[model samples]
Target: MVNNKTCPGCGVMLPNKNLEFSDQYNASGECIQLYHELSANFIMSPDVTFRTQHAVDAYGAQHSGNRVKNIRTAFSLIGLYLAVEREYTGRQVQHAHMELAKRNIKWSSFILPIRPYALSVADVLNIVEVKRNEMLMEWSKNVWDTWENYHEWTRNICKSYLKHF
Candidate 1:
């Protein structure tokens, strides 16, 4: 039922059936318009909601510093996913720990410059991508080497560890 028109928000092709014209002046053109408005308001507002405040407060209680807490939260979420879905254990855990250690170093280097401001999720992702690129460039200096070795080694370690479990 899709027509040739593209969505004004995301710029992808829009379905013809879902596109409706209303006589009312104030009616949003589509669900995408409502979503865009909500997202814009969320970004424009400086004040955190009560729920976010409570969550931040609870998170702060366990962690001594803001950066450390945020990084720890990120790691905890990653670990949960790996453990629950990936079923990583033993040497897999060790491998993950090593990777996380390197990532922490990279994150620390990136965070020191931006520590003064309260960062949004997008800000953190941007910083991470920047640091990751920097790390990759540094790694690529050895022209004879390939990226597969690191991954293969980690996989071997994981396979070995999985044998015992």
Candidate 2:
């Protein structure tokens, strides 16, 4: 019988081959480990323009729930919004985060959908190497779409804080 562990947060099932993350996200250690491997692929790429920065935000937001800190969840949602909606590069998203931080505005956590995401790190981890970036973006979009309930609030935060974005 194959042993598998499912992430309590994202519902990603993987062979029980890694330690679990102990963070507030309550992510399956295997899932977070897989995400690290996928992230390293983008971070180590020769292409400087790939949207690597968005990966953290996308993953975090997709995995967020009541147990996750409100501020952290807010940041993740905002970052995904800028990446998918504003077409902001990872670097631009970083700057937008910085701008929002300067305002010290309180971020309210929304009630996210209870549905498990259609795609997770596991989906893109095994794709053709050349198509990884494209797949990553698609993954990000899918995750962002799952959080559709907060799109309007996300946009408002950007408009209020990231004036130049």
Give lDDT tens digits, candidate 1, residues 96-122.
Answer: 545665532322211212122122122
In model 2, which runs have C-alpha deviations exceeding 4 angstroms? Answer: none
Best by lDDT: 2
Candidate 2 structure, TM-score to reference: 0.91
Error of 2 at 107 (Å): 2.1
Q: Per-residue lDDT for 110-150 in model 2, tens only? A: 68777678888888888998787788889889888988888
- Where is the poorest 10-residue window by lDDT in model 1? 108-117
lDDT of 1 at 108: 23
